[model samples]
Target: MKPTFIKKGIGFAIASVIAGGSYAETTESPVSKNQQPNVVLIFVDDIGYADMGFQNLRDDIVTPNMDKVAKDGVVFSAGYVTGSVCGPSRAGLVTGRYQQRFGYHDNIGPRVRDKNVEQGLDLSVKTFGNYFQDAGYTTGYIGKSHDGDDKKFWPHNRGFDEFYGFNNGAADYFISGRNVENSEESAHSSIHRNDEVIENFDGYLTDIFGDESVDFIDRHKDSPFFLYVPFNASHGPMQAKHSDLQKFAHISDPLRRKSVAMTYNMDVNVGKIVNKLEQHELMENTMIIFMSDNGGKPDNNGSINSPLRSTKGTTWEGGIRVPFAISYRGHVPANQVIDDPVVSLDILPTTLAIAGIEEKEEWELEGVNLMPRMTGKVDKLESRYLYWLTAARSAIRDENWKLVVPNIHVQNPRYELYKISEDISESNDLSSQYPEQVERLKTEFERWNEYNEDSRWGWNKDRYPYTNGWRGRE
Candidate 1:
C-alpha cells in the first residue's frame, strides 16, 4: 500500500526515543574546554561529477547551496569515495577504513532469513559517531542510514544519539510505504524517528530531512554536535515534486528532468540548513563538508558525469570521482582548488582533528588529516595510493597513474592503465606502453588486498545490466 502524505505543519519537533541500548544522556558529559567545533557532513546520494554548478559543467543546472560551499572553502578536484556503490562507500566514510577491510565489498541486498548473511556493516567496528559521542559531542544522524538493519547495527547502537531516517538503501520521494517489498515501489516506505516508525510524513522526503536538520542544529546550539545529513536525492526511483519538476521543464529528457528537479530540491534544502547555521551564529565554528556517496549512476538516472569515463558500477573516473568540498569560514581557504587525491575515509580523521581530539593508534584510520593542506600549513600533500574494489573490478590510483583490472570472472578481462593526470577522461590506455607500471600497481593492489577480508556479500551481476549510452566517451 502506498503511504499517504499527511500535510501536517512543518517544524513540528520530530519525536524520538532511545534506540538499540540505553546510553548516558547528553547532559551526562559537560562541554569540554577545548570547544569542539560543530560538524555537519552533508552526503548527497549518487550525484554526478558534473551535476552541480560548482564544477562548471553546465550553466543550466542550478545548485546554489552546493556551489556556495565550494566557493567558501576548498574544493578537491580528485576527491573519491572508496567504492563506486552506495553501501560500501558509506561504510568507508563512517569507519575511516576501506570497506573491503571489513568484508563490505558490494552493495548489500534486501533483508534475508539467514542470520550470518545479514546485509549490513560489521558489528565489531566502531564508527565515527562512536568517536564523536565519546568525546562529548552530541551525534545526530538525519536522512538515509544504509549501514545496517539489526539492532546492533542501528545508528543509535553505533553511537548516534538521534536518528531520523530509514535503514534501507533507497526510498520514494512522493509516497512512503512499508519495507523493501520491492526495490522501486516500496523501498524505504518505512521511515523511522529513532526506533519508532513514522507512518505518514507531510512534505517531500528531502524537505522533511532539511527541516529536521535545522531543528537539530537549533536545539543543540549550546554544545558541539555532529550532524550527518545523507540526502537520498538523485538516486533511483526518480520521482520529483510537481513544483520542482516545473522548474526544470526545459530539460527535454524525462529522466534528466526528474534528476535535475531532485538535485535542485536537495540544494534548496541544503540552503535551509546553511541559513539556520548563520541564523544561530554557528557558521564560524562549524565545519561543513559536502560530498556524494559515489559517482552518479547515469544508467539508472539521467545524471551526467561528463568529461569522465563510464558511469557508476564500473571502476572508471565517472564511477569513483565525485564533487567534494570542505567549508570552515575562517579556517579553510576560500575558493581554493586542490588537485591532490583524497578519499571518503579521510572524513573521520579530519573531523577528529578539527574537534581537537588526538588521534590514537588503536583507531586504525586509513585516511589522512587534510587540515594542514586545506589551511596552507603545508604546500603539498605527500603522494599516497588510493584504491577501489568491487566484485567485478578493482582500481588503484598511485600518483597520477591508474590501473583498472576487470574481474577475471567476466569473459575477456581487460587490464587498462591510464595516466589520470594527463587523461582525466581516461581516454588513452597506457597498459601496453607501460607494462612495468601496470605490474607495479597490480602488485601494490595485491599487497593491500592481503589485509582485506573476503566479501560478506557477493556482487549482484544481474541487477543493473543496462547501459545509458554514456560509456567509453573520450
Candidate 2:
C-alpha cells in the first residue's frame, strides 16, 4: 500500500515522518541569513470560478479579501485543480503529483474500510508538511484533511507538527451541529485537535480555522512556517452565522443567501488572517496562496460557476478549473495576471522555493517552480500536458486544446473536444470537426495514461451527479 523509495536531497537528508512518529532531522542546515519566507496556503472547497469579486461574474458574490489576493499579486486565469472532486483533488495537491499515479483516482468513500483495497494515500508519499518540516519550518493544517480514512493518513502523522481540523469535510461549521446524519456521516463530522476530539468550540469552524492560523503565525513569527488552512466554508450543510446572513438579506433565495452568507463570513476570516500577517510585518515576506480544491457543485452548495459549462464531478472547465491567486509581497511581481494554465500541484513547489528549498530529482514531483513565469523571468510557462482521470473518464489539456473522453457507456458516446482558449464554457465540441487534433490529443493522453493505475478503493458515485452528456441531464 506504500512505496519504498526515499527522496534524498543532494547534500542533505530530506525529512520523512515515520509511520505515526517523528524522525529527527539528519542534517539541520543553519537557518538562512535572508530569513526564508512563511507560506499560508488557503484552500477553499467547492468554489466557483466566477464566484469571486475578482472574476466579476456575479453582482451578488461578495469576497473582498479574495479579491485583494488578486489585486495585490497574480491570478492564474487558467488555474485548475487535479480532481473535479475533493478527495482525489487533495491527493494530487498535497502530494504534488497526479492522484492517478498511485491509484487514487476517486474520492475516498464508504468503501474505505474494504479489506481488499486500501483507500488512503500511500504512506510513503511526501506532503506539504513533510517538505517544510524537514526544512526546519513549523507546519500546521487548520481545516479538512480528506486525504484518507485510515488514521495513519491523517494530518498528525502526515508530517504536520500541529493539526487542528476534522478528518472530513461534512462536519458542521458550527460546533452547535447541523443536520449531519446520526450514523456514518457523524463519524467523519467531529472536529479534532491533533488526534484528540475537541467536543467544544466558541465560534464558527471557518472562524476557528482562521483564529488558529493567526495564532500559528504569531507563535512562529520569528521562524519560517508553513500554514495550510483548507477552509470547509461554502461547501455543504448550508449553514452560516446570523451576522453574515443579515448582510445578504437582499438576496431573496433562501439557500443561496445561506451560501453567500457563509462565503462572506469566510471572506472576513481571510481578512483576519491577512491582517495578522500585516501586523507582524510578515506581509512582504510571506507567500499567500488562495484557491478552491475543485469547482463548485451549484445544486449542492448554491454555487454559481457562471459562463463555464457543467459543474463538479465532471470533465469540464467548470469542474476542474478554479479561482486561484498568489500574493508574495516584494517577491512576485505586483498586480500581474498570468493567463497560462497552472494547477494546484504547483503550489507545493512554489512554496518550497519561497522557503529556499528546491525540488530534488528523487522526489518525483509533478509540479515546477512557478517563480520564473510569475516574475517575468520567462516569456511563458514551459508547455506541458495537464491531465485528469477518475474511473472511466479522463481528459487532457495540451496548450489551448482540451479533449475529454466520455465513458463509452454514455448515450451517443463520442470524444469531446474544445478550444478552451475560445470556448471557456466548453459548449462547442469539435472532435468531429478537428479529427486530427482529437487523435493527436488522444494519442498523447494514452501515452500519459499508461503510467496511471486503477483507483485503489474503487469509485465514489455520490460525486457523479452529472450525466454523460453536455450538461447534467443532456
TM-scores for all candidates: the values are 0.87, 0.87
lDDT of 2: 0.78
Q: Can you write out model 2's per-residue Cα lDDT over 1-474, one digit (the tens) per residue? A: 111222121111122222211212232223344788889999998888777766766778777776766677888888999999888999899899998888887776444323455557888789988999999999999999886656798988998999988877566776634322322345556777886766555678888888888799878878888899999988998889998888789999998888888887777788778877776677777888999988999889888886777888888888999988888877787777788889998988888877779789888889878988988899799889999887657788977799987673467557898887766777777887889998899899889889986566543444333223211122
Worst 10-residue stretch by lDDT in candidate 1?
6-15
* Alpha-carbon lDDT, every model: 0.80, 0.78
How would you encode candidate 1's per-residue C-alpha lDDT over 1-474 as one tens digit per residue? 111221121111111211211121222223344567999999999999888767776655777776776778988888899989888889999999998898888876542223356557888888999999999999999998886546577787898999988776787676544333332343344577887777654678898898999899878987999999999998988989998889788888899999988998888888888877776667778899999988888768888887788888888999999988899998898878888888998899999999988889988899999999999999888988999888678999977799987673577768899888767788788899889998999899899999997666543334333322211211
What's each prediction's clash count? Answer: 1, 0
Pairs that collide in candidate 2 are: none
Candidate 2, position 416, lDDT: 92
